[model samples]
Target: MTEKMLQQYKVWDAPTRIFHWVNFTTVILLLLVGTLMYFKKDLGITGLEAKIAIKEIHVWIGYVFAINLSIRLLWGFIGNQYARWSNILPGKSFPAVLSSYIASIKSGEPQQFLGHNPLGRLAVTLMMLILITLAITGLVRAGTDIYYPPLGASFAAHIAAEGVDPASIKPYDKTGTNPEAYQELKAFKGPFGDIHIYVAYTLLAIILLHIIAVVRAEITEGGGLVSAMFSGRKTLAKKPEDLN
Candidate 1:
């Protein structure tokens, strides 16, 4: 048997690597805290103080997540060729490319891409959309539920009783708030809360699938798929399809 030759390619950039780990860390933290908050009662966690405290932690973590995501969004415009949206997101010719990639996979010759492969492009786009949804809904809930900033002051003012200081209003407490307006605010936030939670579950499912797909690609394709997120490089045995 002839010796196999492997090539090293600089793929992910520094900002991309940083964003990946930061996003991953913040996501895991948010999920852990969010899960606890969701099952607080069952977990024997009680009282308004505890609930607010947990939510505060979650919201803070969410702030980090949001900032990281925003930076990544901007980076997509100015980062390296592989990290740019032009390469990662599906363009006009995506369907044919996806079809070809799938056919290649079935024929036992999966195409290696320095950036994302066709299916990966789809997955990343879906994942980004989900993450953006989560960020918006989470912010809305942070404002409506615990009276956190960005939307909190406005929500508080909207629900405050006549002549009552919005600043004086407390979260989860109806005191100093107009009963009718408070009820309206609650109704308004209901759908956002629902979407936030359901989409969170969907994200979890997608993350699991993402992990599985990465592992499979690593094993069958001989690329350091997981390590690339950290080292910002990929090792491939064959020529990369998207390499320029």
Candidate 2:
């Protein structure tokens, strides 16, 4: 009987690995803080002052989330082959790859990929988009009332929606501003907030599914994916055709 030969291939680069871990931790923080803010009353905050204190923590971390996402997106363009956008975004080869992967699924020998598989690529893309939307909406809400930076300057515009009274509610900025100017900017917080929430739930669902898929893949496919994020290498059986 022939023995299997394992080959270690360098996959995720250092930047990608760091981003994975930092984003993973940051996302957990954002979710926890966000949930707390959502149920501030139940959490026994007696006053808006106490409520805003917790919100401040969430907003600060959100800044970190925004920066992390921006860098990750930029890295996608210049990072290693495995971390590049070309791999994450299904291009012309995607159709063939999808069909091929789907077919291979039934064979009980999942198709091997040094980088993200097609479905994995799709999931990554969706998550990135969701993250961007969440960041924007979160900032807009801050602008709407909390008046955090990056979006604070635009708070007036985001403060009011169509046919809504801008003065009806107090501006979070609290600096000096023209009531007329604040009133003129179109505000669509209601719609944007809904998208932020619905997409957040969707992201949560995808993340859980991602975890399950990774564990299943590692067990059944013999890929060291879980450790790859930490060590940036994958050990696979060397094909004889590649042997000299």
Candidate 3:
């Protein structure tokens, strides 16, 4: 067997690498806490205090995730060449990239990518959009249910305008003047929570598949997608023009 000679390239920049791992870690935490919050009753998590404590952690972590996602979305515009939005969105070369990937899969040959390959690029784009939806829905749900912040009080105002007296409503898990009003608030906030939970689950499934595909690429394509996110470098073939 012949050894493959590779040229080192600085593909992932420092900011991009940090954003990737922090987002990954935060998402995992969100999933765990979210599950606990969703099933705290069935999980034998008794008392309103215990549930509120769990909700507090989940809500704050969700805020951090939303902020992190915002920075990433902005960085996609101002970041390095490899991290640019244009690089990930289907550009003029995407068709060729996809065709090449398919060919490599069937022929057992490795294809090089200076940045995200076509399939990976598509996955990342979809994940980002989904993350934004989850974040927005989470905010509305938190506001309506617990009056957290940002949009929380705003949602409260809306419900208050609906003939439910403001003084009658209390944040969930707390004694309020009117239990019926709080139930109304919960019903108003229901759709946002539903969407957030559903989209979050979808994102989890996508993350698992993303991990699988990246691992497959690491073994077959020899691109350091995972390691490169940590070290900010990758190995690719030197072009013939550069060899001159």
Candidate 4:
């Protein structure tokens, strides 16, 4: 009987690993805080102060989420070969590549890659789009709903009463705000809130599927995927399909 020969590969870099863990932690916290806010009334939580406090916490977590996402996005442009957008994104040859990968999977000898496999690339692309949507919509809600920064002052100034300072406008308070303009601002922000929440629901499903896929790949492919994110290395028995 022949013994299996395994090879270790350097995969994830330090910045990539840091971004992954930070993004994961922030996403979990945002989900929990968002759930509390969504079901605050059902949980017997009441009063304006309590409601705003929860929202504040959620927004703070979202800030962390947004910053982490931004760093990762920027890193994709300048990071290592495995971390670059060229590796993560599907290109003109992606269809053929994906077909080949699927065929390999069916043959009982799944092809392995140091970076994302074709299917994994598709999943990551979809998730990145969803996350960017979440960040934009969340920021819009933060500004329109709570007078937070970036777009807050503009929205506040737009709705403020004549002779009133935009900075003096308190969230949820009608004073120092023109009624008609306030209503208009509310209408404008409504769709963003709707999209933010529904997309968040979709994200939950994707996250579940992502975890399942990772676990399945780890078991069937013997890549040490979970550990690789921490230790920045992958051990595989065969030569990786994406090895360069």
lDDT of 2 by residue, 1-244 (tens): 9897888888899999999988899888988887887787888876867777787898888888889888999999999878989778878978988888878777876777888777788889888988989988888766655656766555644445556544444544433455555544335566677787787788889899989888877887765999999999888773311112
* Residue-level lDDT tens digits of model 3 in 35-74: 9888888999988778778888888998888888888889
Report the CA-based lDDT of candidate 3 relative to the real structure. Answer: 0.79
In candidate 1, stretches whose alpha carbon ends up further than 4 angstroms from where it belongs are: none
TM-score of each: 0.98, 0.85, 0.87, 0.98
Evaluation by lDDT, superior candidate among 2 and 3: 3
Candidate 3 has what TM-score? Answer: 0.87
Q: How far does residue 226 in candidate 3 sit from its true spot (Å)?
A: 1.5
Which regions of candidate 2 fall more than 4 Å away from where they truly are?
A: 156-187, 238-244
Candidate 3 wrongly placed segments (more than 4 Å): 160-169, 173-184, 237-244
- By the TM-score metric, which is better: model 1 or model 3? 1
* RMSD, candidate 3, Å: 3.4
Model 2: residue 130 alpha-carbon error in angstroms: 0.8
Q: Sort all candidates by TM-score, best to worst.
A: 4, 1, 3, 2
> Tens-digit lDDT track for model 4 on 93-126?
9999999989988998999889998989999999
Worst 10 residues of 2 by lDDT: 235-244
